[model samples]
Target: MVRLRVLFASCWCFVAAASFSQGDTSLIRAAVLEQWVRALSHDSMQGRMSGSSGAQKAALWIATAFRQIKLKPLSPKKSMILPATVETGRLRVRINNVVGVIPGTDPSAPAVYFTAHYDHVGVGSAFSESFPKFAPFHKKTDKDSIFNGANDNASGIAGLLSLARYFFSAPRLPNTLVFAAFDGEEFDNLGSSAYVGQQEPGKVKLVLNLEMLGRARMDSSLGHFPIVTYSRDDKWVIDSLNKYYRIAFGDTSRTKYFLPDPYPERQLYERSDNYIFALEGIPANGIMMTNDQDLYYHHPADEWQTLDYGLMELVLRRIALTVYQWLKASGGS
Candidate 1:
């Protein structure tokens, strides 16, 4: 196992030494992101199936990482792990959704959330091809039983951890920042549903769900760009809410690129954890890097090596910079 104490302390020191700078998000490190994804998506984690041993292992690691990050726990009983049970008519099994918070200056203000799922379709499960295109080269991959969900959602977890590392050390905001890694997203996105049921919906200031951020291809030749999924009305609300950042994400150009739901026909906005939060009137959206048409999407080929770590770093830094700018403009920084 990687040394969490030493590594996290080094990370903390790296942040502590630097003065907080608005619009300066050099804090995001590709190495750190790589480490996170490598650990979470390692084959031994066994695809992190909900309520499975692999899922439990991943949860424990995330919870420990949260503790190392010094985040306040939301659950009093279970600490950072949001204790919940899934009842499948005949079988009810326990699952943990990891939640940690960076408290803000004002305790009463609505909270901002960073969310992603830590579950995926495990091995031995037959999955019909939605749109299958086998990766041109198997190269060195084991293409066997293990469904290592590296890009499916492990990338999201990596991004969330990077965000936590950045925002935790930055200047304090007026509202709390909650980082939540949910369970059972592959099971019809039910984990977030349970979480949403537990929280007061109106108290959520905003929800930014990170999903599939590792391998991004505008096309085969082109580099990475970001896309966020949100309902039409909620889109406006989110854009208005993040107006302070001057990101101009809604109004895109050739250079400043951000896609507005490329797969509207797929109803992607209603798919991930953000949908559950949005249903409760929370201003929520998911920041995804892919168009979801790729060989390694849910396939066994979706290993850690397939991800574009450099592009992932770039996208995450952009997000951090925007959030920093927003926090500065909001008068809490």
Candidate 2:
């Protein structure tokens, strides 16, 4: 018995050492999230509404971050700038989508795409204006003020940047990785729609759309998870994600599920940028904390202070690792 125990201990020690050795590359951390949210959600960005100066500034910042991370531009000459115009009544506003690419070592490998929208609801009626009876104390000062949108989407953009930085700095990836910061997601997903129109569906293997990952609530009930989500016709993706969620989070209760359906808040899956890619038959999915019922959503109170940075970092790291695993399994370029 003593000899057997000794042998088991030795094997355990070897396994632990191997796991440690695999940690040579650092995982996505909270500090990176902090830096990204701070910059993207700064008041100077002015809510980053599509076709607004704030959105343009945010685009420039995202492009700069991609450059700093050494990601090659997928567009011609390593850069792509797509211009779009939206007519809002008497106003005709123009917006642009920023795209970059990291070439994979395997020329024949498929491409994995990561996307996030940087736009949000611009300054508008205060929460109280819509709900005078339930107005909070801070509503008076925050009404009609710039919505910093720290959590609404800046968090997702931060995750996108962190993922890009990781892949750019790490050894050559097997599949081509495309990073896109979409504009006009809040309005009608115009940016992503335009992108889908230009590219062939066969080139994209997966689209991981990040959205509203800043806020963290205490609810662990899978029932609280977002409903009325959308994906491509591929059952493989749904099965894979369902398995991973059950194993990683340990929740196996299957709740009622369906494709995008019109709701009070509109069918969110069809409303966001991911819908554009999904329409093209790409296996696309979105990550978000809001269940479409958060009171602070799109409100001025949606500031950085309300975000759970720790949870945000965890989600981001998990997403990054999951993407890596999926690419490896899918034979991505």
lDDT of 1 by residue, 1-333 (tens): 379888999999787565464323555777788888889889888878787789899999999988887888874654788878876445565778899998888877778899999987655442112112222222223547667888888999989888888888777788888999999776666788888777654477778889998876565343535445455456664454345334523334344334467678877777789888888777788888864676787677678888888888888876776666665566542
Q: Which sections of candidate 1 miss by over 4 Å?
A: 1-19, 75-78, 88-91, 126-143, 219-224, 237-255
- The 0-to-1 C-alpha lDDT of every candidate, in the order given, reads 0.74, 0.69
TM-score of every model? Answer: 0.82, 0.77
Best by TM-score: 1
TM-score of 2: 0.77
Report the error of model 1 at residue 197, Å. 1.4
Off by over 4 Å in 2: 1-27, 76-81, 86-91, 125-144, 199-202, 221-232, 242-266
Please give, for residues 123-197, the per-residue lDDT of candidate 2 as tens digits: 544323433432442353444477888887888888888888766655566788889888877656777876676
Error of 1 at 137 (Å): 19
Please give the clash total of every predicted structure, in order: 0, 4
> What overall lDDT, based on C-alpha atoms, would model 2 receive against the true structure?
0.69
